[model samples]
Target: MNSNIDLKELWAKQETGIPDTKDLVKRVASFKRAHLKQVIYANILLLLVAVFIVLVWYYFQPEYITTKSGIVLIILAILAYLFSYNQSIPLLLKSSYEMSSADYLQQLLSLKRKQQFLEGIMTNLYFILLSTGLFLYMIEYTMRMKLPLGIFCYGITAGWIAFNWFYIKPKTIRKQREKIDGLINKFHLLTEQLTEKK
Candidate 1:
């Protein structure tokens, strides 16, 4: 008796289809090898820049560094940069498998999901850098108790960020929504593959 098996039927029950595990692992491995090198190098550069900023701030403004706030912010900046740098590129690199068949396509799509997550993480890291820079500049003026042009520049920068965030954040959210859709599509494929394998 030949009973036609449609694995996709099972996948339809779930929100995201589970693809064949064999293809999943191999696809992830292959992607990591091809994509991570440049991304890692870029992150390393960002880390170096963060380190340089810390050194410069410490060297030039030892007198102004009475409060621990500036120091804490600097440390936080360094940490955020390092985290994004380490987490994303390595995640990308981990996808170094062979995608010989379409089986791995599901896993590759999952990798894209992780990549989107990394994008959010990196976005936060960049925000930290921007906020810290503004805080430090403001503190410098506040410490001296002097009203100067530099203070005005900082205020303007803050206002600009606020304005852009107010307007631009929605656009960013929309883009993220698209990424989510892409992820879902890939997941569906994965599920289809899994059902077939079964």
Candidate 2:
């Protein structure tokens, strides 16, 4: 009886360190808002780029079929990427502050899976299409240039693409994964705490 009382007192004295549900909900809502904003910004930028490319194609009107094909491939890559990227928007929109912890966790997991797919397969496809398109697109312009200039152009473009593929893309993916993983871990902890309390 004395040990039981001591245990109860110790338990009572211990700090829960658990965050308030309201605050957790607010943080989650903020995350959702930030994510949605990022999506919107990315979509707008990609669309603008696509429009710019189309405008250039219209105004320049290169004689070579390779140039036309390159332009089409680039546009197709952008559109395909946009379509695949937007697939996550609906999942994001489905999440809400009012959701139970378990539900929210499930939603986040789903979003993470979607992100993985985007980062892996879709990204690979986009880069492949873009690289091929760029090479094809440069053919016509480079042919008109002096040999040294044409070689320089190809070298610079290849270097840029390689940098993006090898460095920038991996860095971006790591950052994104860390952010989502942190959020998921927080929610997992919150769910466990809530469950224990019940």
lDDT of 1 by residue, 90-178 (tens): 66457757864454666666776776777676666656655665566456656565567666776787788786566665566468658
Candidate 2, which segments miss by more than 4 Å at Cα?
1-41, 96-100, 187-198
Model 2 Cα displacement at 127 (Å)? 2.1
Q: List pairs with backbone clashes in candidate 2.
A: none
Cα lDDT of model 2 by residue, 1-198, tens digit: 999999999999978677889998999999989988988998999989989988988999888999888888898889878877787566566667688767777677677667666656767788778988988999999999999999999999999989988997778767867876787687678678767788
Among the numbered candidates, top lDDT falls to: 2
Model 1, global lDDT? 0.65
TM values, all candidates: 0.54, 0.67
